[model samples]
Structures are given as structure tokens and as C-alpha cells.
Target: VFCMKGDYSFERIVSSDVDCINLKDPVPLLYLKDHPGLSYNDSSYSYGESLSEFLRKKDVGNYSCYINANSPLIIRKCPYDPYKHHGDDNGKVMKNCRDNGYYHESRDGACYLCRLEGKCGCEHYGFETFINPQKTNETGRVSACGSDHVIFSDDIYSGVEVIYNSENGLNEILYLDPHGHKVKYGMSGF
Candidate 1:
């Protein structure tokens, strides 16, 4: 069973459809058992609990049951951020997840899809610490997770300015070329 980001609050029971099987206490199903002769692989540091075991908790997060993929079955819940998701604090922002709830590192500005529990790609960007986006209203500045700068759409090619160098951690002003692509003005052209 593929438990989504907020599925930890409910009980998920799996049972075989064959006759005489008790439905009250259905056995936690395994994907491997359903597909005979298929190899079962787990690559996570912690060999996590079974689906039935994971379904017992009430934490608000995401988890999975023996996916054929190499990723680990880890449970995670995104923390409440009034500025990141929306104005309210009623946990309704979970709907924004997998929709537009992603932002980049504060220093690099490279976009990441999922930030489980708000842990963005800081480590991947070579930053030892996660730097939250600064809240700004400047026309050309990027305030990724800020109240007015939440990345609502995936269209990245339009209305972009100022860029941060991931390697040097320096900000650079961008100028749109005649072709409409953003480029750093230097010896090349205006």
C-alpha cells in the first residue's frame, strides 16, 4: 500500500479476496507475496517496519510499504509554515503538497520537488546547513519560502532575474537577451 503524506492518521487493512478469509483482521499484504518469484529489495539504512506495523501510528506524514523502487520506506510529515503554504495554520496546506509546496535553497536557488518536513536540498547543494529563504519584496530578488515569494507555478522561464552562484555563493544580476533568455551581462554583450 502506498501511504501518502497524510495517511498516518487512519487504519489501512489489507485482506485476501478468497472465500473464508476473516475480514475483521485482515493480514497486512506484501507486494512481493502477490508477485511470486519477484526479487524483494530494501536499501534503506533502517529496515523499516511492515505496512501493518506502520499503519498503527497517527503521525501526520508520508510512508510506503515495500515499493519495488530502491527508495526507503520512510515516514515524514511537512511542518506547518504559515508563510510557505498559506495564511492559515489549520493544516489545510497539505493539499498544496505535490502541487506547489516546493522552494529552493536560500543560497543557490535551485528548485527541489519534495521537502519532506521542510528539509530542502541544502545538503545536495553542498551546504552543511539548511538556509531558509529570506523574506523580501524587491522586484528582482528571490525570497523562495517567504510570504510573497511562494513558488506557486512551475513556469521557471518567465520573469526571472537575479541568480545566485551555487559554487561561489555570490549573487549576480541577470539581463534578458534578445531571445528572452536570462544571461549575466559581461564582456559578451549588453
Candidate 2:
């Protein structure tokens, strides 16, 4: 839903919603080999390295879901949907991001409030991912998502750079507009 007209077309930004690869593209890496929780390893290996070099330079530069708010394009389509919506029960988030189960298959939740599929606007940075279930995962309350269209204006997200790392907890996302041009995003829960 965010394409400020630069001659468009990653098949028209995945057909109608500029939710990065949801504005689909050539995504077949065939399981990207042994899923380090969909490849941003920490507990295991993937020494090849990529928790967020902007998803390995946007798959070696083929670009999809291009959001240039200053320079922004960082996403976590489903970091396990807030870890299975933790303690779900109509507080909200009932799970169903297409359920491929693990590695790669969830897609619905966490546009924060840009409102996926039904498509809302303000163009993202709507940040929402907060899991505190009593703080056990080492002082929780960081589910991770962010939206600040320069403090919510309605378009052209401005100035956002997140790098949570008390030892790798978000690890980077930079989206800014207002003529500075940027779009970087990375994620991890592996």
C-alpha cells in the first residue's frame, strides 16, 4: 500500500499492497537451508551472515516492496506473530499467518496498524510488538515493530532507526523520509 510512484512494478508492488515481498517477487530460495528460524541465526549457525544487511542486500538487489521514505524498507512480516501471540484469547491476535508452521509461513500480523490486507495508510513505522507476559524471556516487553511516519502524518515515514541489542534483540531497522532516502530492515529471534 506504499508506493510513491517511481515508475512502479514489482508486479506493481506485489499487486496492491506494498508490504514488501507480499508485493511478491522471486522468493524461492527453497527453504533457505535448515531454517535458523527463517535464517537469522544466533542459537545455531548460518555463518554466512544476515540478520539484517537489509535482507542480504534485497536478495542481491532485485528490490520488491520498495518504500523510500527518506530511505526505508525494513520488515518482519511475521516474527512468529508476536511469538504465537503469547497468551492469546481475544485480547487479540488469534494466529493464522498462513501457518507454514516454522521457518517461513506467517504473514498477517505486525504491520502494527498500517492494517494489512484491508490496507490502511500512513505508510508504515506503525510499530507494534510488545510481549511482556510477566517479563520472563529476560525482562521481556519487546516484540518488535515500528511505525513513525515522522510521528504519524499519513505518508512518507520519517526518521526511524531501531537497533535493539542488549545482545542481539532487534538488531537494526532504518526508515526515513523527508529527502534523505533510506530503507534498511533486519530481524531476529533465532
Candidate 3:
């Protein structure tokens, strides 16, 4: 959401879903000749006028226009170095996987770190403590780190499911031992 609290005003040009006050239409054909003081991010495709010229075209005084797409926007506030994953330094691994078109399967249901990598092997990795809320049993994959792990992983695999089991939820098989204790395998414990 963008906000301006000065001697300026703005209007949304388009919308995709709900008419949320902040949502703007996608790639709207805006007539800069009518709305003066309008500037857009058209670096690749040059708009015939200079920034000052475009602003002068609109009668609005000292206005700032923002173009926001309906796509999800994530704001991260941690001192994160995106180069590391687990103890394996899998930055290059992930990039190579993505570049070479290696796709991970989606596993349905909320998963703890051990369950995610061991039981499902969905290529996505995540972690959740007992204190966190149970994630939906939807098929998808994700990897996460730190305090914001759950939310980040959820967004990464939004609305994707691999299995369609109505009787038992996804990630249901718990690897238990004879003593009724959950067993950890394959470096699954954090």
C-alpha cells in the first residue's frame, strides 16, 4: 500500500479483483495529456515527454503517482544473507536447480521440518515449532529460515497441492518408533 500525506492527490486507474482503495489496475492505458503531473516507470518504452513535461501536462500540483500491481508483495526486515541454505550453502544449488528447470513436487498438509524433507521429500524445506499454527494440508513446496519462516514458506507455495486425499490429510504418515516417539532421520532435526 502506498500513501502520500502532502499537498497532493492520486487516483487509481484500474483494478483486478476487489475494489480495494489501494489496488490499481494493471498496465492501464493512461492518457498523460489529460492527467498532468503524471509519471510512470516506462524506462524500456519511452513516453514521448520528459518527466517535467509530463508533470506539466497534468494540472495536479506536485503529485506523486504510484503504480502497484495486484501481485503479492513481501517485505523482509531481517539481516538475511540469501546465499545460505541449511549448512550446505545451497544458494548455488537452488539457483542451478531453478536454472536447469528442476521442479520439486508439492506435498499437501502442514509439515514440520523433519516431516517436510523426510516423509514428503517435496524438494521444499520448511520448519515449524509446536507453538505455531498448523498449516493447511495443501500440496506445495517451500523453504524458509528464521522467525518469519512459516509465513514465507506459505507464500512460496501458495495454492499448490500434489495429493488429493480426503480421508487422511497430507503429510499424515508419522514415522514413529516402538516407544511411540517420533523418529528423526536424514538430518531432519533443526
Give the winner by lDDT.
Answer: 2
Best by TM-score: 2
Please report, in order, the local distance difference test score of every candidate based on alpha carbons.
0.24, 0.26, 0.23
lDDT of 3 by residue, 8-99 (tens): 76666665542222222111123233433333342211223332243334332221111111111111111222222311332233223222
- Angstrom error of the Cα, residue 130, model 2: value is 14
**Native-to-model Cα distance after best TM-score fit, residue 61 in candidate 2, in Å:** 24
| Candidate with more favorable, higher TM-score: 1 or 2 | 2
Candidate 3, which ten residues in sequence have the lowest lDDT sum?
63-72
Of models 1 and 3, which has the larger TM-score? 1
Whole-model alpha-carbon lDDT for candidate 1: 0.24
The clash count for each model shown is 1, 24, 10
- Candidate 3 C-alpha RMSD relative to the actual structure: 23.3
Instruction: Assess the local accuracy of residue 55 in candidate 2 as a C-alpha lDDT between 0 and 100.
Output: 31
- After TM-score superposition, the amount by which residue 141's alpha carbon in candidate 1 deviates from its true location, in angstroms, is 39
